[model samples]
Target: MTTSATTNAAGVATERSSRRRGGLARPTGIPWILPALVVSVGVLYYCIGYTGYLSTLKWDGASPLQLQVGLENYARMFRDPIFWRALGNTALFYVVTFAVQVALGIVLACLLHSRLYLKTLYKVLIFVPVVLAPATTAPVFRQIYAPTGTLNTVLEGIGLGGLAQPWFSNGTFALFIIISVQIWQSTGVVFILYFAAIGQISPEVIEAARIDGAGDIRIITSIIWPSVRGTTIAIAILSAIGSLKTFDIPFLITSGGPTYATEFLGTRIYRISVQYSDVGLGAAFSIVLLLLAIGTAVLIQVGSRTREEKAGV
Candidate 1:
């Protein structure tokens, strides 16, 4: 009996210890959150660090050290007039497009925010441009901008043939055509975002403004503008960033043509990396683009946060 009792006690103790060990094995803390973080860090390191490393090496698309010129690519970039032109063109596109996009988005959002017939249909139709693939749209616009294309046809029929010059051939006009296409394609996205933000404004707030003898214009300028300020800033930032990285439309429509008049940073990088086979220069340009993107993003965040805080106060 004594031997049997001792054996039973030992078995119970072992089972209790096993249960405790199992409970400990199941995660109770930060270890559970580590795998995702490790994966993210690894990805960031590979992309960023690898790019930086490549930028420092003079690779001729075939090998890493066919021509080892330390910082020559970067120095050459400073002396390249075409690079300056591309940078300036990108800035111009950003400024002009951002202004037009914001103005149009605000107007459209306000118009459609009201009771209208077939509101859903209007929304769908307007937002349809935003959903189309960029690649497909670019080539279609290219055809339209051709010398004897539909645009010139309409112009001729309207007795404005004198106004129809070669669209993509003229340096002055090429960037403008590209900008128009971009605005047409991108404004709908801004419209949807602003529209959603406007919907969140309380009807009661508008009613209160009405009771206070405020007109539509006054209400929008005072209440609506102030309320949607965050969204507006966000849209501006996004538009600027998008413009800086613009490649496809310009590449397809103008090919940064008419003497490099519309050569954006993105196109320049592609030319250097692919066309010229200057991997080092391309990598340097890529780094510049990356820095510009990050810096612009940071500025936007700071500006938006500041405005939000002031508005709150």
Candidate 2:
């Protein structure tokens, strides 16, 4: 009896030791994760802080760039008329492009979602432009819109030579052409996004609406629209930000021709920094554009969140 009791006591001692060890081994947050996050944040802070410092100085990017001038560059930026013009042009591009792209994307998405023939072929054709390099497309369109280009050639052939005014020859028309190219290049992306969003929608819900005598238009308006409202908002916000920073297409096609007609902030910064050899002012413009982008993004997020809350409540 004593032998059995001693054995049971030993077993209890082992169980207590194991429980103590298990309790001690429980995780108390990782050491490496916090340090890595700190390093990442520090690097980001340094980059932004350095840019801000550079914006205040009058650095020509040569011969002592660390010199400070106390906001002279920023002051000059405010007085620059070209900056204001670029800002206005950017705003106009964003508004017009966002409206047209979203409207056309929804229409196309709805059409392609149906049981149409050649659906795969249609999708491939539509998505082809989205994958092409923007640089290649810019020059291609330039040829198409040039004075003696295919567009004018086609118009002349149709005996509509009067309709073929210089598409990119003048200031007003150059901006218009740039916007047109942007619309053409970007519409495919919008279509693909909206098409995917629509496909995610439950077919049962759509069928139920149809069975209840709801027409296609009615079902789209009452059901699909609400379901994809988040995606629509997201697309609008993305288009707005993208339009503001439009550079390569405009630069390659128009080169800010006809007295700075296509002078967006991006192109303007490049001209000042590279062509005129003024680094400080260009840095200031870069800072301004970054702030504008951040502000617009935040506003979009806030507006979207408010709408979501209202819908939920």
Candidate 3:
């Protein structure tokens, strides 16, 4: 009986080993991934290749593709003063909006994530703006920023009528007003991201920190921030890219007006392509915008990697 049992056990072990080896040799999921890969490649090639081909031509939308002014459109774009101003505006929007949104988001996320009452209601209210369509929000804000609009009326009612200026008409304040509107609409996204990251942190770790007499600020700085560094980096990159490609609000609200004070590359591209009928110049602008976005994301990724490596993470 003992001999028979020993033989049966040996056979079972060998079968398990063989099954493990087979599983390792044949990886799964490749069949499911090929369709997604094909679709992504097709879309990328169609968009990028067509845009690049159009950039070298000097054809209006109605004309045949006969005139080939290689790189002249790009040259013209670089020499245009409006282009420089738009670029500067894009950078400013990215920097200021990104800083304010992230800071406000972090604060809000921490508050909501804590043991505060009515957390669910606070989260719903904060996140409501994110789900609203831009079409709806843009027009509402336009009216609110109008001379005799809700904002001005409120300011007058509060006995601060002097503080209420033409929010969208003045070149000096148009960009800042637009920036504030963007922050108001999008800060909820950043808050949710940080909130999710904060939730992933171990409760035991936080409890231990509290036991060691670490105050709330110190705990956040020393533990929470480091733990969510990856999320912060991702949000930063996303905010920068979104700011660079900002179009709808600025275009719809101001039409890049008040003497083109709020013009960005996105609006500029639209004006060149659709309004001015200069397809080639618009294509060149699109290419430049694409390159700028890619370069910024790459730089951020490299910086992140360098920091991680230096810290032995």
Best candidate, TM-score: 3
* Candidate-wise lDDT, in order: 0.86, 0.87, 0.91
Residue 310 C-alpha lDDT in model 2? 88
lDDT tens string, model 1, 1-313? 9999999999999999999999999888678878987888889767887777777778878973566677777888889898899989998999889899888887788889887899889889889998898788988887788888989989999999998867888898889988898899989998898899999999999999999999988988999888888898888788878977899889977889989987999999999999998888888888888888879888988988887788685
TM-score of 2: 0.86
Worst 10 residues of 3 by lDDT: 59-68
Candidate 3 lDDT by residue in tens digits, 1-313: 9999999999999999999999999978988998998888788878898898899999888976558899999999999999999999999999998899878888898888788999999999999988988888888888988999999999999999999988877986889878888998899999999999999999899999999999989988999889989998898899878988899889988889899999999999999999999999999999999999999999998999999999999
Q: Which portions of model 2 show Cα errors greater than 4 Å?
A: 1-45, 310-313
On residues 91-141, what C-alpha lDDT tens digit does candidate 2 reach at each position? 988988888888888889999999899999988887787788878898888
lDDT at 188 for candidate 3? 93
Candidate 3 residue pairs that clash = none
Highest lDDT: give the candidate number.
Answer: 3
